[model samples]
Structures are given as structure tokens and as C-alpha cells.
Target: MSDEDIAPGSDVEQEVLDDEPKSILLGIIGQLRKGGDLSRVTLPTFVLEPRSMTERITDFMSHPELINNAPLNTDPVGRFADVVAYFLSGWHIKPKGVKKPYNPVLGEFFRCRWDFEDGSTAYYVCEQVSHHPPVSVYFYANPQNDIWISGHVRPASKFLGNSAATLMRGTHHVQFKRSWPGEEYTVTLPNVYARGILFGSMYLELGDSVVLKCPKNDLVADIDFQTKGFFTGVYNGVKGRIKRESSGEVIYNIAGKWTDSIQFTKASTSEKKTVFNAATAQIHTKVPPAEDAQEEFEARKLWERVTKGITTKNLDYATKEKTAIEDNQRVILKERAAKGVTWQPRFFTGPVDDDWSFGLKE
Candidate 1:
């Protein structure tokens, strides 16, 4: 199947840009230097996915079932493998092309809830804690199932000659509230590369290494997301090994294409089994409250007009609405500065030691 066949909302024309947008992009490309920071770049509305980054972060929770029962596993190795499966499941849910979500304004937030078949519910809240460097902090909780996750992401974008890369700098803290209360498993992110941005068919790829570690269990999974080379190499390939931290003994060997299936083989017995199959997995829906019911700063409510314009193929209106929101944010920041006041995030705190955290932790 094609990438569009698997991507949700693929019916929308996302991959191809109009003549006007193409010219705009070409102009921007001409001005950008190789290795230039893209944080301040104003991309056209056509390249934006109809959502804010604050809400987009919830993609990681799409396959909540993969982790709902993780705490029930008594074996630490079994639990760790489940975490790996959950982490790898999120990458396949991207849009059909090289599109980026709206850069959320400071203090903007998104909240949603997932209702599982078993009647248990998971709640998630995400906030844009910083705007300059673009740090987003989020928290997820399924108290009834004893699962909790809190993390922050600071994406740093850079322009390569023919590609663009977003260095995902962040940490995810996953914990089982009931099974192993204080035992936290830390997970790092893989950098995202948008290849062929200046020439061939533009496509997104996750590259570099992702480290998932549990110090208490002395286990670490070093997964490498391999990017396709210009003339060779397969897309979406991933390879890794789970090892004991103390002695550096390999426990399980992991290999496969993340967009298709990931399998793990036992180190000693050589027994192989499929861990995650993206094609067959069902992505659960997250239900955010109705837009009319959301607060002014909520992601969906804040970008409602812009999202509506994008979805309806009205790029000019979308650009106008998007610019209005950004201009309003500037006005708010200037007002705060004039009053000698600080703009604080409504749902998150810190960067105290370079760590932004959810403020309301239960």
C-alpha cells in the first residue's frame, strides 16, 4: 500500500502544492543557507497539517492498548519489551507528506481523553511552555490502569542542502503507578529528517538513535532508525538490541521496518516473535471536548478558523487567520513586557534545570 493509504485523513490533497505555494517555497528556499535554523522561518499555510504541535504530540498515545496492560506483566523484561513496542507504534501515524503542525503559541494547551473498550479512560494534557526554542510539555494518565507518562519536546529545525531535520531533544518518563510505582523508564527521541525537500519526491524519515532505559531494571534498548540513502538503502528500517546495563549483555535483538512490522529475537534461545505490526494495529481515537466548549487558549479552539480554512482548501483565508493568531500572541507578549509581568504556561512549569514538566501531577 502507498503511504497515503495508511495515513489517516489521507483523502485530503496534502502532498502536492499549488503553483503559488511552490513559488513561495522556492523563494524561501533561495534565501535559506545550508544548516540555517528554521525556527523563525514562516512557512506557507499549505505545508501545515491542520493541527497544533501541542495536540500533535498526542500521536504517541494513539496505540494506548499496547501499554494499558503493561504493568500487569510481572517480568521486567516482558514489561520493557512492551514499552518498546508502544514507543515504536507512534511513528507510523504521520501525515502523507512533508508537513509540519502549527508552532503553538506560548501558553497554548490541548486536552483530550481516550475511552478504552474496557471502560477505563486515559487523560492527556499538553501545553506550549516556551515559544522561542519551542518546548512543549505534556502529561498522560490512566489512573485506573496505573499508567502515566510525562515528557517535554524541544524540536530544533535546520535546513540541509536537500533536506531539513528536526532534532528532537526531549525525555519521556513512563511509570506504572500501581505495578512499580516509582520505577520510571526514561525514553529519548529520534531526529526527524525530511528528505528531498529541494528536489525529488519529498518524504519524511526518522533517523539517529532512540534510547529507552530503566535504571532500576538495568535494561536499555538502543534502537536506531535508519534513513534511506540517496541511491540505496530501504526506508523505515530499524535495528536495535536490548542489553543489560551492568554487564552489557545482549538480551534481545530487534530488527524490522517501523512502518510495517518490528520483531524481536531472544538472544539466548534465538526465538523470534513479532512485537508490533503497524498495518494490523488499530489506532484508538482521542476525544477532545467540542470546540465551542474549549477554552480560548485550547489548541482546537485557538486554531479553529485556520484549521477550517486548511481543511476546506482555502489557503488564503487560512494564511490570514494564522497570521492573526500569531500577531495576537505578539501583542500579548508585548503587553506583558510593558507591565513588567512574565507570561506563564497554564498547564506546565519549569525548564528550571532545562526540564519543562506538567504542573498538575497526581
Candidate 2:
């Protein structure tokens, strides 16, 4: 039977599933998990470069002159072997299917800082592919299309030699693209949200397939929809409460336990302060429980991380090393801000030429 015909509970299925305990473990433990054995979960990410067929084929032994000069007495089987050898000689070889190199990364995770919109941004690590291989696309079937403008991956230094210290990978690095759709209304994601959900202009059902192409090569990775609907980013914060609303009613809220179809009474003056008075709406946010130190700590850390990443890229630096140092410095400032420290940077412009020459006095 073909691969798809195999049933999930069958031996073949079990074998396939059991073969990659590492990926499953990585998916569960995420980035912060400690211990020496768990350290392998972090892989050095790399982009694959594209190779043309002509460049790949030029060195092969199957060139016409080499094949045609074979002995006349060569048996049919021997001659067939010769033909096979000729063709196989120069086709640039690499594993053709899933056996291709997979550099799984524990991608940098951060809280979605977009307050004006409830959205989830994901950096899916996949083989870079230029053309649409065997894959599918779905969205709200509108003429204008739901896809926003596409952007390619930037040249970022990546960790080399297995350790997380990044190295400059390549000039022709992996090619990737990112796109978002335009929606009518602005949605808000509160700082305390433990999970994030974004509604697309298009809807997709469970078991449907979509393909995400890799930027560097022509590799295409197919992802099947396990759950119907929107993409989810479960927050690492365990202390705060979270809620989701559609129209007027609360669709989801995770506190002590997960609940749906519930309404939230305002838990705080701060919570009430942010509520909207509309026809009906959904709200999710962190209302820090009084005296809950652990929850407060986690929330503050998440806030600091998001703000630092957003702020550091804009700062000027004398050199790249200076820029790196400044970025770390900004993180310290972010932590201070989260703790309500009353400190701000002293702004200054370049000094004007002194009036020491006495030209201004004259």
C-alpha cells in the first residue's frame, strides 16, 4: 500500500511516530528547558541554497562520448548497467525526499505585543523552496485576495558549529516570505493573554492541507490541519488569566480550568478600565491577582522581552559590537521600566561650535 493508506494505529504508523521522539520532546519542552540531554533540542538553523540542473549535470559520466565508446561484446545486462551508470554519473546527488537535512530550531518565542490587533506570528522553520511544490493554499475566497504583501527573509547571523553562537551563513541564504491579510476591524491582545488566536479572512477546516515553502531552496513542506480554524500560540505565562471573545460572548477563558461560553465579571479596576462598550465583544487579559508574586513576575518578564526586541533595533551604535552592547543595555532599561523605575534616557544632539572665538559677543 502507498504511505497514506497506512492506518494511524498500524505498526507502520507506530514506527513512524516512534522514530522521532526528539522532535516531540522539543515541541513539548520548548526553549527554556534545561539539562544536558535537552540541550540537543536547540539546533543550528541554516538556509539551503539553490543549485541549477545544468551545473548539477555537467560532471556526470553519462556524457554521450563516454557511453558510446563501450565494448561491443558487452552483454545486454552489462550494457544496461553501463547505460544506468552513465545517466547516474552527474546528477548532483542529495536525498530526494524527507531524508533531506532538517535543522529543527527552538525558534525564539515572544509574546505578541500588538495591542491594537489580536494576532499570532509564527516563524516556521522549514526547507527553503522557491517554487510552489506540491502544496495547497486556502483563504476567504475573495477576488481581492486575503494575502498581504510578501516580504523576504533578511540576512541574519545564525549560530554555527552546533553551539548557539551565530555565524554568518551565506550571501545567498535561504529564501522565505511572510504575508498577512487585511481585516476590517482592529482587535486587541492584552499583556496577560496566555494564548493568542488570530482570525483570517479565510477559514480552513481540519485535515485540509497547506504548504509552506522554504526560501533558500525549492523545498516545500506540507502541513496538515490537525484542528480546524485559526493558528494558536499558547503563552508560557501560567499565573495570569486569559479570555477570548467573538461578538458579545466569551468564547474561551483559561483560569483555574479552561471554560467556554462564559461571561467575565470585571476582576479589577484595571480590567474594567480597558473594557469596550460596543454591541458585544470578547476580551482576554491579565488581571494580576493581588499578592500573586509568581504570576506578576512572569507577566513582567514577558512584557520586558517584547518591549526590548521592539525597541533595540532602532537604536544607533558606533559599531556592530556597540549595537549589540546597546541592545543588552536596553533590556536592562526595559526591566527597570517594568518595575516602575522612573528613569528615562537623557537626549542630546551634537555639540554646536563653541563661541570661544568671541564672534557671538561681537
Candidate 3:
């Protein structure tokens, strides 16, 4: 799928259930037990979002403008707040209902660039570094703005009766290359829960807590993404506190819905102001080269037939194409095993102490 296919205002939210039969879905669920891992399970094509997980990581980079001026902020606390705003900005860009992106094959990569209005540009590259316990590693940089972000996401999914939860484990390190070169803001991700997978209307929610901390600045934000409980609470509610790490003194109170607007209130002055409003926030455009221009192992090129089948409402064809790709991967893996060769990623390197890094120099 092209970048525009998944961009904001696309028809990605329109649920297509015509290809998924209830009995088939139930049969698949019958084989799955509570707390079972879904990493190896083959799911229905209709539940796919028509994109690879490697490409999905770009969603977090969609609002680079949020942190563009962070390096220029003299106050350390102000810079910390900018990082928090950028982290919370991406959660609102998602397809409606519960859908998962394609499980990228090992070594599969996606690359794109974002050109800002000021003539500056940012580049993003990601790779499926591991297949068995799927891990995706990515790097994004805006050299002109002295902004750099590198991260990896390992999604471990579990079946929880009527719901499926993806325990997101990873860290994103944001740094200002030129200014405060050694100082970094470390960020964590919220766990994703897909509710009503077995019955009722299936929907997605993010729960648990996320911490954004900077050791050099001694500032931190403890944010909790609250999910709706049975007949209680509300969807997409987020509340947190920005504080001084050394004294544990709260500086600002953060409250708002991630899918809408987020407001921050200063503890000392009781001054409240909206920090990010999803309703009005402009999602900067991302430019990806045409499919024909991509390499053979690039995400869009590898899944072209499958994506075409999905977008054209020919799901049966999509399933056939998807199966062919997976089956071909198995053959390649077996061949590699016979040759005693290991598959290496193109854009990333490691599990170096269980962490991956962008192989190329920034």
C-alpha cells in the first residue's frame, strides 16, 4: 500500500466484514486458549490493515513539528514537555475497529522521507529485524532541525477470553543532535488491547502506563492511558503528571482524551492550556517512492499483490496472495538453515544486548 492509502482521511476506517464468516472466525478462536501467543497463528485476511508493521511505525513520526523547536527551548522542563506532547500525538492516528498490520517477514524494510514546508526534510527507515517473536526497529532523523529518534517495538500478543492484548515492549530515545548532544529523553509505549475479539463489536484500546524520562534534565512524565472498563470509565482517557525526578515534585497536571485534546495544568499557578488537539493538529504528509521504484524486499513491493486484492474487495484473492508470500518465506528460511547461514537485516543491526540500532551513520 502507498503512503496515501493509510494517510489521514483515507477510507481505512470503513470496516470490511464481507470476507470474514462467523463460523470461520469462531473455529479459529476455538483452537486458541486464553493467554495463548498469537505470533505464529494465521489470521483472517479481513482483519489486516493492508500495510506492514514496519510502515506502521511511521505513524509516530507523523507530527515531527511537535518537537521541532525542542532544541531551542532554554528551559529543560519545557523541552521535556515538548517530548511528552510529541509522544501523545501519534496515538490518535489509527484505523477504526480492531485491525492488525501485516507481520513483516525477516529483513523486510520500508523507507520514506518527509519534506517540511521550510525546505527541511526528515527521513525514516525501518526493518523487520526478527521474525519469531516479531521485532521491528526504526530510525528517524531531521538533520537540519538536529532531531533524531531511534526505537524498536516488540509486540507480544495474548488471547484473553473475549479480548486480545499486545504487550508492547521497547524504548524510543529522542535526542537533539547538535544541542544537548548527550542528553536524551527515553520513552516507553502503552500496551494495546483489542476488545470483543470473540463476540460483540471488536474495537481497539491502549491501556497501562508510559513514562518519558530524561536523566540529564532530571525531569519525567508519568502518563496512564486509561481504558474503559465494564460500564465504567471512558475510552482514550489519559492522565498524568510532569514532575522533578529529584524531588518528586509535580510541576504540571496532564488531563485529556488522546483521541481528542490534551491539556496541561501548572501546579503552582493553576493555569490550564491545551497542549495538543487531535481535531486540529495537522498530520504532516509523508512521501514514499512509487511501488515500482522500491526494492524487491521493500514492504509495499513484497505485499503488492495482497494489497491490491484487499483494496479491490477481492479478499479471497488477498488470502491466496498472502499465503503465497508466507509459504515462500518458509522455503527461504529452510534453505538458509540448510546452508548454515543467518538472515541479516539491511537497515538495522543487533539484538546487541537485546537491542537493535540503525546500522548506518546518522
Candidate 4:
């Protein structure tokens, strides 16, 4: 069976059919709206999903085909368009209305890999590098395709009456090994939102504009994520165009739904082709089991008990463990601060910089 066929469930998923958790979440929103920080608020463990944010970090790898053959394209401009399709593939991994994922503890990290059918492995690593601004640093590399992605996200979220909007402040660095003098493309992230939170109909929508640009190739893709409108609109709408960076002349027109497929049309011939198909796509995010993962770098190992408590509907156990973990992280931060020691990311050198060098060539 494929990895996507496996749902996020444990022996405990069956026990979490109660509706009492919604009231607790609603109360937090009222407090947060009054200038209370989301980071400082203590969320009820009953609302926790069975997975960790570190596990959700692997969602980008859900579309392996898009990234695998992108670097093989001879036309750097066309390749940039394919990369844009790839960047759009990470959304809508789960059905809407699910509870929020467990926030990663400070110093928490996750490591996993996907072995492609072509014998290439897509390796991924994510670290919760900051707590105050809630920054997550991630690295994805596929040795076979000679493609590497590195980025860090510092998300600023606000409750906009009925919906919560998160503006992602980050740039995804995509590098290829094929042609164009070893060029790199910077891919911007789309805005995230959860709609109908105030009236009880909760669904996700990715909105706003995102750009993908390759300076060396003079290629650019302008993508617009459209949200569902009040009277007449569809959910998960997306539209875009690919153009030359110098002349601003569109080479291709792109459009599709985020929950289904994306198509690109050539401006010259008006021939349209589907670039990505989500309904038929499958992804494999391989992480070691809790029993086998390394002590420090393992996501499953660190959150095993909490995961068990969540899955088994043991709220008391889950809440107790979650509190303990957060408390320990605070104590560790204090000790490190007292000694004038600063914690550094293991892979990312300058997590805050615009151009973070991988030193792959260095």
C-alpha cells in the first residue's frame, strides 16, 4: 500500500469522538484577541492532533515526481515553472476541520527520508530553532536529483474576527545541478488561513500572491492563491503566469485548483498541459520508528508518550506529559542563558539571513 493510504491514527484515534474540546479552543481565541500571545497560552491537550509539527514537516515531500525531474529539464525557464508547481504541491495534505498539530518543543528536531523508485533518496530534516518568533528551519536534499532545498519560517499569525491569517516570512532556497551556471531560485510561501472559525465551519484556504524567481535565468512565475468568496466561488483556487524577468512577457499561463491539479498553457501555441495532479499523486515520508530512532534527533522517540496519550484518548496523561516537556525546555533555556551559552542550529548556519550559504560548493 502507498504511504498516503495510511491515515494519521493510532489505537487512540477511535476514542476521540467527543465534542467538548471545541469550547476550550473558542475560549483561547477570545483571550488571544485581547493582545495575548499564542506562544504564552496553554492549549488543552484534548485538542492536540496525534502527530507533531515535526512530522508535519515532511508534507513538502508529498510530491516526489515534480521535484525529481525538474532539474533534468534542459530549459531553465521551463524548469522554474515546474518548480513553482512543486512549491504549490505541499498544501491540502489533510482534510479540513482537524485539530491543530502539536507545537514543537524548543530544540526539537525531526529527520526522515523517502527512497524513490529510481533509487534516489529524498532526505529531510526540520528543527524548531526559535520559540519567541516560532521559527522552523528545514532542509530537504535528494542526492540523485542533485536538488537541495533550505529555508526557515517565522510565521506571524493574527485572529481576523472569523479567520486566522498567518503571513509566512521566509524564502525557500531551491538549487539544482543540471544547467544555467549553477543558478538558484528563491520561492516565496503563500499565506495560510483557517476559515469559518468563529461560526464553526472550519476549512483551510491558501491566499495571496507568491513569486518564484531565478536571477540567472531571468525567469519568473507569478502565482495567486484565491480564496472562496461569499456567494459564488470555489475553494482552493489558484492561478498564475510564467514570464521573462527582463521583458515581463508571459511565456505560459497557469491555473488550477489547489485540491486537484495545476495546468500550464503555452503563450505561443495556446497548448495547455497539466503540470501537477494531486488527487492521483502519492508521497512517501520515511521516518524511523520510535523504537529505532536516534535518541536526540528522533521525533517519534521524543513525543512517544504524548502521542500515545493523544491516540488513546488519555487526556490527563497527554496534558501532564506536554506540560513537563514545556517546563523542561524552559529550564534548559534558563541554564543556557545563565552560562552565556547560545544554542545554534545543527545544519543551518545563519537561520535569519536572506542568503544562507549551504557551503555545498564551499
RMSD of each: 3.7, 28.2, 5.1, 6.0
Residue range with the least summed lDDT across 10 consecutive positions in model 4:
9-18
lDDT of candidate 3 at residue 206, scale 0 to 100: 89
Position 215, candidate 2: lDDT: 22
Looking at model 2, residue 263 earns an lDDT score of: 22
For model 2, what is the error of residue 35's alpha carbon versus the real structure, in angstroms, after optimal superposition?
Answer: 28
- For candidate 3, the clash count comes to 0
Q: For candidate 4, lDDT tens digit of each residue in 29-128?
A: 8776632345556778864667777777577778878878887788777688778888888785763353567777776777777888888888887777
Q: Give per-model TM-scores.
A: 0.94, 0.15, 0.93, 0.87
lDDT of 1 by residue, 1-362 (tens): 23333245422223545577767888898898999999999899988989999998898999987888999999999999999989988888888878899999998899999999988999999998889989899999999999999999999999997788999998888999778976789999999887666654567888998899999999999999987664555678889999999999999999998788999999999999998888899989999998678999999999999999999999899999999999999899999999999777777768767676667633
Better of 1 and 4 by TM-score: 1
Clashing pairs in 3: none
Clashing pairs in 4: 12-311, 12-312
lDDT of 1 at 272: 98
Candidate 2 vs. true structure, TM-score:
0.15
What is the overall TM-score of model 3 with all chains considered together? Answer: 0.93
lDDT of each: 0.87, 0.22, 0.86, 0.73
Model 3 spans > 4 angstroms off: 1-20
Q: Candidate 1 vs candidate 2: which has greater TM-score?
A: 1
- Which of 2 and 3 is the better model by lDDT? 3
Query: Which tens-of-lDDT digit does each residue in 151-173 have in candidate 2?
Result: 11111221221112111111111
Model 2, position 328, has a per-residue lDDT of 61
Tens digits of lDDT, candidate 3, 289-316: 8867999889999999999998897989
Name the runs in model 4 displaced over 4 angstroms. Answer: 1-19, 34-37, 355-362
